[model samples]
Target: MDENNNLTEPNDSQRNFILAIYILFALSVVFTSVTSAVGAILAYRKRDDVRGTIYETHIAYLLRTFIIALIGIILGIILSAIGFGLIIIVLVEIWYLFRVVVGIVKFAKKQPVTPTGYFM
Candidate 1:
């Protein structure tokens, strides 16, 4: 709350930053891991700035997604010896894409998102 006792929401830049992170995650699923890593780093670095604001949840969400995807990628690589790893990798990629879509849609609608979940 501000001096007027009104709620102080995140500003436009913060909002745009969230959207940008979503974009980076979405792109990373198909094109490159670099963007995802970059997005995760941004989220990690900005986590404090978003506390008590809407972006805080988004940063948490992004971090969770990044970690889950990393784990899935590793597991997929380990299982690749049996060929099941291919399936695991594809599933992880699909799951990651689905999550990115859901997150971005909810974010665009300005919905309140939970920080923890595979789905929005």
Candidate 2:
């Protein structure tokens, strides 16, 4: 019984981490840069815990999404000085929404995100 409980604890913690990722992603849509950064940090901190498990893919997906989004935002800001960043920022926002929605859907269905080697 004690062994069974020990096994379940890790599963529960993993599930909580997954849930936290989803919530942070959702919050990022509303709070923008702040929550997105927080989400990325959370994923980074929890990465080791999920290694070799299904959630590892999620961490990778989220980490990549966060990095790309940050880059896009920075580029957008820089280009805005030249009047091109508005479009880039808008596109990046859409991409963020799409990634979050897809991630949530896959998570809901309890399926692993297929490794695409790039942002999906």
Candidate 3:
């Protein structure tokens, strides 16, 4: 409502949402596959806010990575069972790192960057 407020950075809620999503992304590799789904659900439920949208995008990216890893793991298991699927897992890990770096940059600068694609 005031000029000061208008010029201020994103409020607490927005920051929290982005932080939570970042946490989830960082933990995705360490946690079980189901964790991605849980994060996605949280993002969707809180979709009314800017933070929520960022989380939603984060969730989508995690979900995609999870699915890709799952497939790679399964294929590796079936094909060789010698750990060939670790490649996919490694790729996802790199992607997570990239996302986090970009996220931090955007958040720190107070830029309105959407984690999700055009649909969000």
Q: What is the TM-score of each candidate against the true structure?
A: 0.89, 0.85, 0.54
- lDDT per residue for candidate 3 within 1-120, as digits (tens), equals 212234334567767875675566557667764665565556566655643333334445444544555565566556555666566556645655565566556656654444343221
lDDT (tens digit, per residue) of candidate 1 on 1-120? 112223248788889888889889988977998999999999899888777676677788889888998999999999999989999999989888877787787788765466676776
When summed lDDT is taken over every stretch of 10 residues in candidate 2, the lowest stretch is 1-10
lDDT score of residue 103 within candidate 1: 79
Cα lDDT for residue 106, candidate 1: 72
Pairs clashing in candidate 1?
none
Cα-based lDDT for every prediction = 0.82, 0.78, 0.53
- Between candidates 2 and 3, the lDDT winner: 2
Full candidate order by TM-score, most accurate first: 1, 2, 3
Clashes of each: 0, 0, 0
lDDT computed for candidate 1: 0.82
Residue 18 miss distance in model 2 (angstroms): 1.4
- 1 or 2: which has the higher TM-score? 1
Q: Which tens-of-lDDT digit does each residue in 9-119 have in candidate 2?
A: 237689788878878888978876787788889999988898766677778888888888889989999999999999999999898888888888877775556545454
